[model samples]
Target: MRPALHAEEDVLLVVDPQPTFMALCPDELPVPGAEAVIPVINRILAGPIARAVVTQDWHHPRHLSFASQHPGKRPLETVDLPYGTQVLWPDHGVRATPGAAIHPALDQAKVVMILRKGFRQAIDSYSGFRENDRQTGTGLAEWLRAVGARRLFIAGITRPYCVDWTAEDAAAARFETWVVEDACARLGPDDALDASRARLEAQGIRFTTADTLHGENA
Candidate 1:
């Protein structure tokens, strides 16, 4: 049986639903079908989800994670950073740019907070609760806990990266975590997404679709 979400205990987490990340954009890191998730997420917000939080990947121009900043490093090429292995990306989500802005299609009015990350120009932030260094905290956990948001319904773009990291952290933070599967898109192959799903399941993070959310009688 599927679990019921109580708005008092559960808050929707919309991750990186930006135009720059959509396949239609073609310039920034485009996750195929990313744009399609917005309406599903909006439907959830307008119905079962009364409270929400949104994340934006607000990067800086020439950010260290960008391949252009590192000579001879191509996008998606792996390299060692001071913190850990890093994935190089094309310049994206530059601060003050449209790519950095949340997609206007999203139901932003329902969101209680907007968390902007990856602005430091050195560290990358995929997890909404923590930076890539995994040491620096973003205070998302604290805010959620303080507000009594006990379960998290995470949705939005690039399921294998930002959404994946946020779900892992939410589980670690002891929130009953659920990933809205259809409300997410991916940048990589099916096997990569499969691997990420397996790991998240191992950590006890459950997955559901946006359809399930709206179909519920509750």
Candidate 2:
């Protein structure tokens, strides 16, 4: 039998489930079928697992990571920043905009933390625990440790980026991490997804489906 998830032993990390990435926002960085993850995540939230944290991108207007901030740059283009090769993105997650808010459909009743990140104009944040530079910390790992959480189940919008990075960081921080595949939306193709899976698996991150998590605890 699969190991059952316990409330005190396990925690949920919902990464960047904002309207900015949903199909409704075609201009701002929409991920295909991103809205679908809400229900899958809601099911997980409604499950036996109790403690949870949700991450928000929360970027500022004209943030440096945005293509609009750099003249002649386009979305998905690569430019070398002080940190490393940075992928320019369409203006997204601007604070106080409707797109930056967490999707209204997501259940937050069990959420204990609504962690907002990427608000700085100079840096782009992908992981909940750290900025893109990888040196500056967000203190999420410390918060989890303080709360005595050991097993981490991550889910949310835009897999292979936010979800991938968060899970990898969680694993590196010594948490038993699992990524709920079906609960994550992606902007890439199957091959790209496969590549991310391999990369994450190599880092000791495991994968599961939302159905499996729900059924196991049911």
Best-performing candidate as measured by TM-score: 2
Give per-residue CA lDDT, model 1, range 136-183, as digits (tens): 999999999998899998998778999999999999999999999988
Over 4 Å off, model 1: none
Over 4 Å off, model 2 = none
* Local accuracy by lDDT, each model: 0.88, 0.89
Which ten contiguous residues of candidate 2 have the minimum total lDDT?
A: 1-10
**Candidate 1 clashing pairs, residues 3+ apart or interchain:** none
Q: Candidate 2 residues 1-218, lDDT tens each?
A: 24488877799899999999987788899988999999999998887788889999998898999999889889999889999988999999999899999899888899998899998789899999889999888999998989889999999977888999899889988999999988999877889989999999998888888778877752
Report the number of the highest-lDDT candidate.
2
| Candidate 1 clash figure, as a count | 0
Against the correct fold, how does model 2 do in TM-score? 0.97
